[model samples]
Target chain A: MAQTLILEGNEGYVLSEILKLSDAQHPTGYLSNEEYTKYFLKSVKGVSNVRKTLAQQINDPTITNVGIIVDANSKGTKARFDSIKSTLTQYLPTVENWDYVASSPAGWVADVAPSFRVGLWVMPNNKDDGYFEHFLTELIAPEDESFLAAQEMLTSIQKSKNQRFPDLRAQKALLALFLAIQEEPGMSAVTALRKGLLRHKHPAARLFVDWYENTFTLG
Target chain B: MIEHLTIKNFLAFPELEVPELKLINLVAGKNGVGKTALLEAIQLYKCSDKIGTNRLISENRKGNIIHHKDRIFASKLEINNLSMTMAVGDYKSKVFIDGEQVEGHGHPDDYPNHEYEFIRSGIKEHDWISRRWSSFVLTEKEELVTEVISKVIGLNIFRIAVTDQSIMVKIAGAKNPVNIKSLGDGLMRTFQIAMALVDSKPLASNLIGLLLIDEIETHLHHSVIRKLWKIIFEYAIKWNIQVVATTHSQDAIRQLFYEAAANESYQEKVQVLRLQIGRSGKHEVIEYPYEKLEFMMDTKLEIRGL
Candidate 1:
C-alpha cells in the first residue's frame, strides 16, 4: 500500500523541490501504486484553513505513514515541535519525543488502530528557530561575494536608519534580495531549489534530506 | 441500523469495502465513478421479491450480459453481526445469512423480503403514491403525512382531498387546490420520500431498516435540498432507519456537513463517503467524517475530486 505525506502549506513549490531531490536520491520505488489505483506521492495540505482536518488525516485508515513539514517560524523549533506533539498526542498518545541527533532524526512514530508512522521536520533544521527562508539562507556559500555584498548593503541601509527592524527581519530582507538576483527572481525556496540556485551539496540542505529519507524511505 | 458494507466483484466494483457507514450517508463522486452502481448493489441485497437468474444477470451487466468476464460478484451488508451476503454467478443468484440460504419475507416460499426502498431519479408516473395518498388522507395518518411535508417544504399543506379519479393537495401559498402532479417534479420528489419514510417507520411487524436512493436531491433547488436533508435526517434518526444515498450536488454535501457538525447528536450519524481513483488506478472509497468534510468545505477543495 502507498503511504500519505502531509505538508504544512497549500502551495506546491516547496513540496515539488523536496520531491525533485527525493526522486533523484532514491529513484527506485520512491512512489508505488496498485493495479487499479494510481498512488502517486500523497500529501495533505495543512494550515489554519485545513487544521480541522489534520486529526482526520492522522487517523485515516488508508494512510501508512504521515510526514509533516512545517516552518519553525517565530515560535522556534522545539516549541513548534511541542505544539504539534501536544495536539497529536490525543490521537497517538504513545508518540515518542522529538530526537534531533539520531541518524534519521526522532519522529513521533505510533503503532495503534489505523496504526501508522509519524515523522516531522521543522524547516531550517528542527533544532533552530525562524522560517524556511532562514534554512534556505544557510545554503549561501561562506565565500560568495555577491551574497555577502547584499547582506552588507542590507545591514548598512538598516544601520543608517537606526536599525528599525530586528536581525531576523533584516536577514529575510537580505535573502529575498539575494534570491531576486537569480533567473527566477523572488521565487519560493522550492523554486530556487528546483533551478539549482540552492546548492543541494550544502551541509544544511543535507540535514533535511537525511531526515526525509530516513523517515520516509528507510525501514 | 446498517453499519458496514463489503463488496467483491459486484457491478462496477472489483473489490470495494466501506468499513464505516453512518445513518445519513451522502456519497459523491464524478460521473462513471460507480455512484449509481453502489445503490444498485444495495437494491440487489434488499430484493425481497424473486428475480429470474437471467434477468438479474442482464440487469447488472455492463455491455452484453453474456459477454465473457468474471461472472461471479458478491455484496455483503452488516447490521451489527446480523449480516446478509448476496452472490450472483453466471445466471444464478443466491442470498445467504451465516452461510445458510435465506428465503426471507415477501415471496411466501422463495425470494428475499428486505424492508427497504430504492428511489431512482428521472420522471416516473407516480400513480402509486397518489392512490396511497388518496386513502391516506381519510385516515388518522393524514396528519403524519402533513407533518413530513411541512418539515420538508417549510410550509403547511392546508388540505388533502382524494377523489375517485385523482388526488387534490393544497399548500400554504397556492390559491386553488390542484392535483398532486400540478406542483411540479421537485415537489413530487419530496412527497415521494416523505411518504416512503412515513410508510417505512416501525410498524406492527416491521422496522424500516434501510433506504437506497440514487441522487436523493435531484430536481430540487439548493434551498430545498437543505430543508429536505433535514427532514430525511430527522426521520432517519426517529425511525431507526439507515439511509444510503448518492448525490452529485455540492450544496447537498455542504448542508449535510453543516448540520452534522452543528448538531451534537448528528455528529456520529452523518458521514460523507467519497468515491475516487486510488493510487492503483481503480476506484476506492474513502470516508470523510463530519469535521473533515467541513474543513474541506471551508478550504473549497472539490469534495468529488473533480
Candidate 2:
C-alpha cells in the first residue's frame, strides 16, 4: 500500500496543487494507483493534532511511511524538528537515525528511520525561521514588477502602522493582497497556481516539489 | 491474568500468536472462523485441570480441535505468575506448568473432575459453575453477593440460600423466592460472571485469572450486556484480571464502543480481533483499534462477517 503523507494545518490546497503540477511534469503512477504507489495526503488542524495522530500512526502496521510538512516559524529548524521527534520517540522507541536534507534556503527535510521513513519539511527552507508564505514569497516570479511594487506598498503601509503586524504576517498579507489583484482575484494559492498566475515552476517552489516527489517515490 | 497467548495446530488456526494482548480483549469474527476455538484453547490451558479431560473433550468438542494439516495441537499462555502449556493429540491431552508436567494426557477416574469454580461457558453444565454465591450465603457474605448481583443483573438479589435439594434465590422484581435454575439463562450467565468477579472471602482469589466466554452476547440484551460490561470492567481493573470473550453481535460491539468512548483508557485496553478465512483457506486475524472500530461503526460497515 502507498504510505500516508501528513501535513500540518489545512495546507491541502498547496499540497494538492504541487502534486497536480508534479504529476503533469513527471507522469508517475504513484499518485493515481494509491494501493501500489500513490501517496495519501492528510492534514490535521495543528502540530498538537499531528502529535496525537502520529502517536497512533506509528503503531498502525498498515501505514508504512509518513511525510510531515510544518512551518518553522519563530522556533528554528532544530526546535521544529524536535517537536515531532519527541512525539515519535515517545510512541516508537525503535525510531533511530536522522538524515537532514537541505532542500532550499528556508526548507528542511529529515529522513528518520525504523521502517516508517518520516520526512519533515520546515518552510521557507532548511536554515531559516519562516512559514509557508515565506516560501511562497520566493515563487513570485522575479520579473513581475507589479508584485514587487505591491510588496513595497505593503511594506510602506506596515511602516506607517508602526510595524504592529509581525514580519511573517506582514509579508503574508502582502502576498494575499497581490493574489487578490490577479485577473480572477481572491483565488487561493492552489487555484492561482492552476490558472498559471502563481509560479509553480520557480526554482524555489521546484525544490519543495522535488523534495516531496523524491521522499514519497517508491523503489 | 494472561498477558500473552499462542496457539498452534488448534482447529482452524495452524499458528496464531497474539502478542500485544490487553486486559479487556474482544474476539470478533464470522461463523466457523475459530472464535470459539480460540477461547476453548485458552480454557484448556487455564481451567482444564478443574474439569477433567473427558468432560472437556465432551463439552469443548475436542474431536475436530486439531488443524487438518497438523497432528500435534499445542497452546501456551502466560498468566500472572505462571506459564502454562497444553498439548492434545493421539498421545493424549497433557498439561504442563513452567515446563514441569502436572497432568497426564489420559482421563483419570479418581482425579477430581472439577476444582476451581469460576470456569463456566454456555455449553457447559451449571452444576460445575462457580459456587461463589452459595459460599457467600453460607459464610454470611451476603453484602458482597447482593452488591455484585444488583450491579451486574440490575436486580437486587436480597435473598439467597441453599435448600436441601437445590439453591433458591429471590430478585427484587420477582413475586417470590424461586430456584436459581428457574431464573433463565441470561440471569444465570450474569450470576456466574458476577459471582466470579465479586470480592468474597469464601471464593479463591487467583481463580479470577482469565474470563473466557464463547459468544458473550448470548441470551442478553445490548443494554444489559453493556451494564454487565461496566461492572466486569471495573472489577477486572480492580482485581488485575484479563477478559477475553467472543461476540458476533454488532449491538454488543456498539455497546462496547459506547463504553470505551466514555472511559478513554478502556479504548486502549480493548483489542478487537476479527478472524476471517483467507484465500489460502487459512484463518487470517485482522486487529482493529478502538478508534478504527468506532469509524467503522459510524460508517455502518458490516463488521460482522458470515
Candidate 3:
C-alpha cells in the first residue's frame, strides 16, 4: 500500500521541487481538500490571504511525509507553523511537513515521518545558486571557475556556506541538487565525478538515516 | 546567568576547552574551520541539559555539526556549575544532570520544539525590568525582533521579525514602537541589550549580565558601530549591565575597544577574547587588550572569519 501526505507551504513550485528530490517509492504527495481546509485555510494566513489552488501529484500510501516549505519573508510564519503542527496533531495516522525551499534550514515533522521545511533566510537565497558555485569553484573545484559556475547552478540550494546544516537534514537538498544536475547540460563535466555514488542507490541517503536513529529518542 | 561552557570530542577539535568567559568573546576562524560550530556547541551544551543528552548525541552524531560522517561519536559535553555532562556515541548514551540521570533530546524545552521556548520565556518576563537590557542574534536584520527578538525580548519590543520578515513597532519618529524589528540590525541588537539591562535591574543600578552574539557586527556602517558602542556603554553605566558578545566585523571590533577606552566603566569591566583556528584545526583563544585590538583593526591585517 502507498502512504500519503499533505504538504504545506507558501510556494507551490518549491514544494513540488522538493517532492521531486524525495526519491521515495510513493513518498511524494500534496495536500488533499480535507487537509487544505484543516491545515491551510483555517490557519491565520489562509484566513487573511486568497485561497489559491495548488497542483501537486499524490502517488500512493508509501508517501508517509509532507514538506512544509516557507520563506522567512512570511509575515507571521512563526504563528503559522504552530497552526500547522496543531492542526495535524489530531489527525489519525498524521503526516509530517517536509521542506524544499532554498536558503532555509532543514527541520523534521516526524508526526508522519521526518522531513524538512526549507526557507530563504535559513538557507540564504543569495544569488539563487551562487554559493554552490563558490563552494564548488573555491572549495571543491578550485581550478575550474566556469565548471564551478555550472555546479552553482546545479548545486543544492542551502543557506550560508559559513553555516552548517546537520547531515541529517541534508537528504532532500542533496538529492534535489543531484536531480537538478541531471536535468541540465551545464554540469556534464562534473556528472562523472558525482556518478561515482549511484543516484538511485543514494549513498548520501545514509547520512540522514544515521541522524534519525541517533538524534531522535524513542518515546 | 549561564556561568560556563565545556566541550569534548564530538567532531573537530577534540578536547576543546575554555575557562569562565567575559560578557563578549570574539570568535574568529577560517571558513569551514568551526567558528559557528563553537556557537552551536555552546547552544547544544546548555540546551542539551534543558532538552536531553539523547537528542544531543543524536543531533551531533547525525553529522550536522561537522558535515562529515555521523560516526563522530565517543564524546562528552558538560557545563561547570551545572551538573550534567552528556556522553555521546552510537548505541549507548547518558545525560547526568545535577547528580541524577535524565532522558529525552533536542532543545532543552521540547523536542520537535513544539513552540518557540525563547520567545515564550521572553513573554513571561515582559514586565518592567526587562525593557533595559537588549540582546539578539542579527541574522535577518530588523526581522530579528519580529521572529526572535519579539519572542525572547518580548512583544513590547519596538520591533518584531518572523523568520526573514521584520516590522518595527514604531512607525516614524515616535517615543517607542511596539516591535523593534522595523529598524536595522545594529539598532535592534542594541535595543535588545538595552531592554535586557533595564528589565534585570532597578534604575541607575549596574546590571551584571552577559550579552553573547554570534556576529558582534551586522549590517551597520563603521560610524554607526561607534554610535552603537556609545549608546550601549551609556545604557550599561546607567543600568549596571555587563555586555558579552561575539563579532567578526573589524568595524565592530574597533568601535567596542575605542568606546571602552573612552569610557572608564567599560575599560574596567570589558573583556574581549579572540578565538582563532590554530594550526592543527584546534581553537586557540587569545585575550587582547583594548589598545591591542585597536592597533590590529587599524593595521587591517586580513583575518579569515567563520
Candidate 4:
C-alpha cells in the first residue's frame, strides 16, 4: 500500500527527520511545492491546484492513506483546517460516501471508500496562527539555554524600527539565530533534529507524532 | 461529443462506465486493461453498418469468424440531450434511441449520421492509406493536411499524390517525388493519423465526427509527440471532431497536457481517463479533467495506471 505526505514547501526534510525520531516508518511518498516549480500552488492561478492533486490521489487505487501538512499562517488553524476540509469535500469521489468529523485537538482523519484514509494537520501546534518554523522553535531542547537569548534578541529587533523582516517572519528569524549558535552551526532543521539539537519529547512534538501515528496505522 | 459511455459484457469489460469525456480524451492503463477495447466499443456504437463493424472488430482482434458461444456487447452513450443504447449479440443486434427500441433490429436510417474512423496501432496497410489520400486530394482538406505535415514534421511538401501501389509526396527541391513509406515510420504514422482526422469530417454541418486511435505513440518520437498533439488539438477544434486515443507512453501524456494547458480555450477541452479492473472483478474508470491532469503533470505523479 502507498501512503503519501504532502507538504506546502520543502518541509519534507524536517518531517522525515521527525518520523525517524518517533520510530515510525516514513510514508511511501512525499510531495511538496518545491518539486512543482512551473505550476507552483502558491500562485494565484494555482490556488486550487492542491484540490486537483487530492482528487487524483484519492482516485489512485494503490494509495491507501494521505496526509496534508500546511501552515496556518495569518488564516489561523481553524480557517486553514476548514479550507482543507472544503477541498476534500469537493474532490472526494461521490461513490466513496466519505463522512468526516474533526478529531480531537486540531487534526482530522477520515476513512474514505475503497479502503483509504485521509488526514489533515495545520502547522504550529494546529491552534495558533504560525508556520513550520514556529513549530520547530517549540521543539528547542529545554537544556539549550541559548534559545532564550535568541528569543530576547528577536523581541528587541521586533521593537526596533530597523527590523528588516516582516512580523510574520519572526519565528523564522528566531530559529535561524538559534541554529546559528549551535555546536554544528548553520545546519538545517532536519540536520539539527538528527543531531538531537531539538527535543523530540516536547509536548508540541508529541501532539504531531500522535497525529501521524493515528493517521497512518500499518497493518 | 460523447460526454459519457457505459459498457456491459463488451470484450473483457463485464461492466464499465466512463463519464465527462472532453473534445480530446487520452485513455491510459496497463496491458489487458481494455484500452483498445474501449475504442472498439465506441466505433461499434457509432458505426451505422453493424455487420461491417463487427467484422472489422473481429478481424482487428484476429478472433474466429464465428463464435462458438454467444457473446453480447452492450453500450449506452450520452451526448448533450441525446441518449443511445445498443446491444449486439451472436443471434441478433438491437439499438435504442432515448429509451425506445427501434423496429426491425434497428436499421441504419434510424441512427444519426456521424462519421467515424478507427485507426489501429502499428503501420497501416498501404491500400488503406492510399484510399484515404484519394478522398482528400485536390481539395481544400488536402492543403490543410499538407500544411500540418510541413509545420509539424518539418517536411517541405509541394503536394501529395497517390500512385497505383503507393502514396507519394513531392518534397521541395527534389528531383523525383519520394514514396511516403520511404520517409520513415514516424512520418508515415503521422501521415496516417493526420489523414484519419481529416477524413472523419462530418457530412452535415450539424453532425459530429469521431476519431478513435489506438496506441497513438506507436512510432512517434518523444520530441514529435508534442507537435503532433498540437496538430490534433487544432484539427479537433477546427473540425468539430471528438478524439479518443490510447497511449502507454508517459511522454505522450505529458506533452498532451502541456499543449492543452498552454492554450486557455483548449484547457477545458482535454481530459485523461484511467481504466482499472477492481478487486471485485469489475472494470472501473477514473477521470482526470484539465485541472487534475495539470496537477499530476506538475508534481510528476504517475498518471499511467499499473
Per-candidate TM equals 0.58, 0.56, 0.36, 0.76
Q: How accurate is candidate 4 locally (lDDT)?
A: 0.70
lDDT sort, best first: 4, 2, 1, 3
Which digits, one per residue and each the tens of the lDDT, describe model 3 over residues A1-219? 112222222333222222234432222121353433332221113321111111010111122233333322323344444444444443223444433333222333343333322111111122122222121222222344443444464343444463265543353344344444544533332352354222312322232222222222211
- Highest DockQ against the true fold, candidate: 4
Judge candidate 1 against the unseen true structure and give its global Cα lDDT, from 0 to 1: 0.61
In terms of docking quality, model 1 is incorrect
Using lDDT as the measure, the top candidate is 4
lDDT of 4 at B4: 66
Off by over 4 Å in 3: A1-219, B1-6, B44-168, B171-208, B234-243, B294-306
Model 3 residue A126 distance off true place after TM-score fit, in angstroms: 55
Model 4: per-residue lDDT, tens digit, B1-306?
566677665565656788567889999877667888788777756654446555654566663131212533223222113223433221234554334443222233222443477888888777877787887888988987888887678878888888878778899889899988788888888887877777776665655677899998888887788998998898888877889999887778888888988898998899888887642335788887888777676676667354
Model 3 chain A weakest 10-residue run by lDDT = A51-60
Q: Which window of ten consecutive residues has the lowest lDDT sum in model 3 chain B?
A: B114-123
Residue B105, model 1: Cα distance from true site in angstroms: 15
Give the alpha carbon lDDT tens digit for every residue of B208-234 in model 1: 456777787788888888887787788
What is every candidate's C-alpha DockQ against the true complex, given to 2 decimals? 0.07, 0.04, 0.01, 0.16
Off by over 4 Å in 4: A20-52, A72-114, A119-122, A125-130, A162-169, A180-187, A199-219, B64-114, B134-144, B159-169, B176-182, B204-206, B277-284, B299-306
Residue range with the least summed lDDT across 10 consecutive positions in model 1 chain A: A32-41
How is the predicted docking of candidate 3 categorized under the CAPRI scheme? incorrect
Candidate 1 chain B weakest ten by summed lDDT: B103-112
